[model samples]
Target: MSSPTPPPPREVLPWSRFGEAARELARTVADSGWMPDLVIAVARGGLVPAGAVAYALDVKAMGTMNVEFYTGVDQTLGEPLVLPPLLDTSALAGARVLVVDDVADSGRTLELVMQRLRAGERPPAQARSAVLYTKPRSVIEPDYTWHRTERWISFPWSALPPVTATATDGA
Candidate 1:
């Protein structure tokens, strides 16, 4: 029997591509007519897109939640964990809040973050999530998503182009 061919390397979604996606997402959120009291960015990947969205919406107050899932090469070995510096729910109480993230992979991160945000001493009744990309299999869907793809997205850093590598290496 012949063996099946292995899949090709994942395509790189560069910063410029992410920027375009973020812009589209920002426009969608802005046109929704739902003004958020604050923008809560899921740390690390979410920071850039959230900042762009906040700027587009003219939102001032920004907060972050740091959650770590993978620690280097062992992506599947660790239990998904939320890091310290819990969000100050007091600021979100009874207000509309927008939770922003780069990609909704398995939906676990967003779901857990939303749970934490809602489980606070004072929870916001109205909370929505926005993501730049959503995988087809994502369990929890964001209220707003800029793009959807069935294939896993390889970010810029993961698949550095020759030009990017040369620039970084000063070659």
Candidate 2:
């Protein structure tokens, strides 16, 4: 027997809109007069948006922190787990930092990242967060957000299933 199909996403963020959202989020940050010296992306989901925002803000320094939280659609682990290839917090010292994520849904991941970034002897002088979307129930509200939605979101980068060897065999 086959597993049940997941329901369609309530909101679909196309590639075009993703670009716009990144720019808008960056604008919010710029308007606030807090330009970051470095941009740290919450890897996997946040990589794309972080790059876009960094480009928009002309921030040359960038880093990534890999965190695994959501297991599947609307599914999650008890808490977020930081994956390997960890970011070097040394670079954050005395620099204005911006943490970028695709969405601040549960806010656990963001909270964990923020804590880790702010801990230790060397921490950023000032740290802020940015996201394309934020849920109402989020534990931490990001400094800059492009939209707020409670329903499932189909991000352009994650909308499709992973490409397997079989899928590429004939192509």
Candidate 3:
């Protein structure tokens, strides 16, 4: 009988490394002399890193743009969709903002967010992007990226399966 094929290899980012990476990324922005007034997280992946970067940079103003793109590993929707609990565009008006995400796998999600951020009559004074990882096939390069890899990554936060409710009745 023929054996089943092995799964593809993936890069793993442990929690320990993630903290250092996020700090280093924040330092990159600081060294660039580009001080953003606000930091925008692209939820749900960007939430963690954005908070880290914002804290590191001492940027008090923070917000989130909820976008759902990836359905599962190597799976994506036809296009990215902006979910509800949307961020107010007014916050972008004349403000220097930093957009943060976990990875730029396809770059489509980032593009969509950028387009929307710049759409309204009063767009931010400046907008930049930062990410923990960048894939080889990504179309848009982030302003700050800690690592570049072609392999799928197992981020510490997402490596585990979602938590399900426990049965109240004992088996």
Candidate 4:
């Protein structure tokens, strides 16, 4: 015999809270006293928090590495795929990097991006990771994290419910 399936847990973040969370992550990085010369934001989720972190940390060099992992809610590809245009090594050489992402679920995405960043002859001097949330199942632990939980998170930027049909729903 088997037990019935349980519903997935959920955590919702409002925009205001999201900002605070990002600042909180920035503070964590700042406390480390290891300022990065550049910020590499994982595409999509990382974009917003990475921008906030860069602004807060006063880091002028900000770039993004697009990696497609999540296909839908609680769904993801078999493996994280690196999407181009890949970050140019011309800018990364000798730069210290702070990798930012919204969440580290399985941590595979972070792992993949790190591998890419560290590749090539002139890799960055140092690279650290920061994320708003870290899941218990994450394979890699981040250097800086605002929260650690196992619940599924609904980020403010990606949590819009489907628009209810109105008189002019699709108009």
Candidate 5:
């Protein structure tokens, strides 16, 4: 008989844990000696973490980039797609920008963001990217990373349990 293959291991990152990671990331960015003029978060996943970082650094201006890479159940075969109404490039001109994201999975999102920023008419004087968590084997590495793990992390919503109403019997 042929041996059966084992299922992939599951990794969970609770909301509290994620928050702690974000705080640590904020601390690292503060200690990096680079004061960003604006904070640009790669939207959706990056929004929460970026907000925390912005608060920690006391930065007022915040921007977001909405990019979609996944659509359905199958996680394979996807490319980064930038949503329209992008942040104004003029605001970033001659300013330091801190790009924030939640995790760097394949690094495609970060790579594309950098590319777009570089192509802008008025790019930032200096641009740095940060992430709460990063896969150690990621091709593109963030300037600042809070934690590194090998397991693939599934967001809470993705694994949420189904809701069901329970009936109570009274005596």
Candidate 6:
């Protein structure tokens, strides 16, 4: 048997549109009028977008939960996995939360967070997911999205290629 064929690379270039894109995404959430009491970011990628949305909604409360999905360019685990130390949900008791991620590639990671927030002993008042971009293949649709694209994203924070191992290790 042969290894499954890897997907073709889909590079997205967003040179100067980072802030604009983030603000646009935030607007979508505000327009929806869900009005979260707190903003919870899926760390790494969601950090910026979540902050922007929190500000747009005038939601001062914010938190972050880290999860790992992508391992390398065009590579990912069969399922998105939660990474700890998870965000402290104690403050989220009875608070409506807007969960933010950069993109929803398969939607599993978003689903995990949503379930976690909703199932805890002191579950939140409500929880919703949002993203800057959404792929058609996502298993779960987000409550708010600014754009839809199938291409692998080129977020401003992660646009540059990683430095070679040799350079980092001084080999």
For candidate 5, the per-residue lDDT at 155 reads 60
lDDT of 6 by residue, 50-124 (tens): 987788778898999998888876688887778888777777888888999999988888888898888887889
Order of models, best lDDT first: 3, 2, 4, 6, 5, 1
Residues 73-166, candidate 2, lDDT per residue (tens digit)? 8899999999999888987789999999999999999999998998947999998999999999899989999999998888999988997777
Which model scores highest in TM-score? Answer: 3
Model 2, 167: alpha-carbon shift in Å?
A: 7.9
Per-residue lDDT, model 3, residue 66, is: 97
Each model's total of backbone clashes = 0, 0, 0, 0, 0, 0
Evaluate residue 4 in candidate 1 and report its C-alpha lDDT on the 0 to 100 scale.
Answer: 97
Error of 1 at 140 (Å): 0.4
Predict model 6's lDDT versus the native. Answer: 0.84
TM-score list, all predictions: 0.81, 0.93, 0.95, 0.89, 0.83, 0.85
The TM-score between candidate 3 and the true structure equals 0.95
Cα deviation of 126 in candidate 4 (Å)? Answer: 0.4
Candidate 4, lDDT over the whole model: 0.90
Q: In order, what lDDT does every prediction score? A: 0.80, 0.93, 0.93, 0.90, 0.81, 0.84
Estimate the overall C-alpha local distance difference test score of candidate 2: 0.93
RMSD of each: 4.3, 2.8, 1.6, 3.0, 4.6, 3.8
lDDT of 3 by residue, 30-125 (tens): 999899999999999999999999999999999999999999989999999999998988868999999999999999999888889888778999
Cα error, candidate 4, residue 130 (Å): 0.5
Q: Per-residue lDDT of 111-158 in model 4, one digit per residue for the tens?
A: 888887888567888989999999999998999999998888989888
Give me candidate 4's TM-score against the actual structure: 0.89
